[model samples]
Target: MDALIEKLKGQIIEQLNLVEVKPADIKPDAPLFGEGLGLDSIDALELIVLLEKHYGIKIQNPADGKKIFESVRTMAEFIKSNGKD
Candidate 1:
């Protein structure tokens, strides 16, 4: 799980082109949006693409995106639950 979380931080930074962010700067349990990373809807869309492109895990229900993208830990857990990690 820790490995997955670390890998995800790298992916998120790279995919979002967050030049100012580093993998070490992200807290696994920190929220990915709002007061956390300050991500918006567009960043959410990019995250969706990131999941599918990297893990082959697709978000079948758009509503689930809220729960799934809550944080790096959540995303890693989701991938593990789906056997994608």
Candidate 2:
């Protein structure tokens, strides 16, 4: 899980183009799409695609998207449980 989290952090940093932040700077439980990391709706869409593209996990329901994207920890857990990797 730790390895997966680190890899996902790197992917997030690259995909989001988070110029000012480092992977280690991201708290696992940090709010990734708002006050904590300051991402917006478009970034959320990117993250959703990222989960599908990289992890081979598709979130069909928008409501499930909320639970899946709450934080890095949550995303990691989702991927770990459901990812093709």
Candidate 3:
């Protein structure tokens, strides 16, 4: 799933328009929201849509989303384990 992490990192950075931050800069354990990346609700929505669009997986509930989106590692695992692609 290393390739999936790389791709997700790239997508996150790209979709969020995070200037000056490369995909390599993001740590797998670093939280994507709150104090870690300072991302907000909108960013979370973007990420959810991104996952669905790219991985063919639909996050039906926001509660589950929080668990799956805890970090880069979590997101990659979530997508890989739950994604249809």
The local distance difference test score of model 1 is 0.91
lDDT of candidate 1 over 52-83, digit per residue (tens):
99999888777789999999999999999999
Residue pairs with backbone overlap in model 1: none
Compute each candidate's TM-score over C-alphas: 0.95, 0.89, 0.89
Residue-by-residue lDDT tens digits, candidate 2, 8-74? 8999988999988999889888877778678988888889889878877777875687788888988
Q: Clashing residue pairs in candidate 3, if any? A: none
* Regions of model 1 farther than 4 Å from truth: none
Per-candidate alpha-carbon RMSD to the true structure: 0.8, 1.3, 1.3
- The regions of model 2 sitting more than 4 angstroms off are none
Give all candidates' CA lDDT scores: 0.91, 0.84, 0.83
Question: Which candidate order results from sorting by lDDT in descending order?
Answer: 1, 2, 3
For candidate 1, what is the TM-score?
A: 0.95
Scored by TM-score, the top model is 1
